[model samples]
Target: MNENKFIQLLKKGDEKAFETLYNEYASKIYGLLRSYLKEDEIEDALQDVYVRIYRGIKGFKQRSKLSTWIYKITVNTAKNYLKKQKKNYLSLDFNLEKNKFTSKENVEKDVFDEIDYEFILNSIEKLPPLDKTIIKLRDIEGLSYYEISKIIDKPVGTVKSRLHYSRKKLQKIIEEDQNEGNG
Candidate 1:
C-alpha cells in the first residue's frame, strides 16, 4: 500500500495497518535502538517506540515523511525512557570480553580484523549521547542531514556540525586505539 493510504488506515485505527507498519519498520527501529541501549533495555524501548508511534499517528501533521516522523517518535520515546529510568546514556554495556565469537572449528583470521570491530564499537560507546545518536542516524542508518535534523529536532546546520565533530571524535578514538595496540 502507498504511504498515504497506510497512514490513513493508521489514523483510523486499523489493526492490520498497525501490524503492517510494525513489520515494515521494526528491524530498522530495533537496530537503531540497539546501537544506543543495552541488550536488556532494547526490547522495552522498542515496545515504547511502537506504542508511541501508534498513539501519535493520528496527530501526525504530514509535514515530514511518515518514516521521518516514525524515526522522531522512536528517538524521543527512547530518550524519554532513558530519562525516566535515570540511566546514564553514555554508559554502554558491550561486554566484549565475555561475549567472544564462537566458532565450531578453529579458523585462522587476521588479528587486525577482530580488533578493529570491537575497537570501533568501544570508541563509539564512549561518545556522548548526542554524538552517538547523530553518528547512528547519519553514519549507520544512512539518513540525510535534513532527516536526521528532523529526528533529533535540530537544524540541518547543527546536525552537519555535530556529525562532523562526531566523525572526528571517532577517528581520534580509532587512532588512539591503534597507537595503544602498536605500542
Candidate 2:
C-alpha cells in the first residue's frame, strides 16, 4: 500500500496499520535513539517515540515524508528524554559490529579497519551533542541535508555547514589521537 494510504489508516487508528508502521520503523528509530540515549534509556525512549507517533499521527501534515516526520519526532523525544533525565551531555553509541572476513588477508585488513573506525567513533562521542547528531544523521544514517534540516529543524545551509564543520573537527580529533599514539 502507498504511504499516504498507510498514513491515512494510521490516522484512523487502524491496529493493523499501526503494527505495520511499528515493524517498518522500530529498528531504524531505535538505532537513531541509540545515538542520543544510553543503553538503559533506549527501550523507554523508543516506546515514548512510538507512543507520540501513534497519538500524533492524526495531526501529521504531509509537508515532509513519513520517515522524515518520524525522525523529527524521534529526535525531539530523545532530547526531551535527556532533559527529563537531567543529563547535560548526549553520547553517540554507534553499533559498529565487526564483520567476519574469510581470508587471512581480509581478516588483517578488517581488523585494522575496525580499529580505525572504533577510534573515530570514540572521537566523535567526545563532540558536542549537535555536532555529533549532524555527523550521525549525515554520515552514519545517510540522510540528505534537506532531510536532516527537517529532522533537526534547521535550514539546509545550516545542516551542510554543520556537517562540514563536524567532519573537519572529527578529522582534527583523529589526527591528534594518531599523533599522540605515535609519540
Steric clash pairs (candidate 2): none
TM-scores for all candidates?
0.76, 0.79
Q: Where is the poorest 10-residue window by lDDT in model 1?
A: 100-109
What would the per-residue lDDT of candidate 2 be over residues 1-183, giving only the tens digit for each residue? Answer: 998999999999999999999988787788788778888899989999999998899999989989999999999999898889888655676753433211122323343354456677788787878898887777666678899999998999998878777766766776788889999
Scored by lDDT, the top model is 2
User: lDDT per residue, candidate 1, 1-183, as tens digits?
Assistant: 788898999999999999998888887787667656667888898988888887888899999989889888887777776788797654443323333322111221232236555566677777887887787666555678899999999999999888777767766776787888899
| C-alpha-based local distance difference test score of model 1 | 0.74
lDDT of each: 0.74, 0.79
In model 1, the runs with Cα more than 4 Å from the true position are 89-119
lDDT of 1 at 27: 79
Q: Quick one: RMSD of model 2?
A: 5.8
Clashing pairs in 1: none
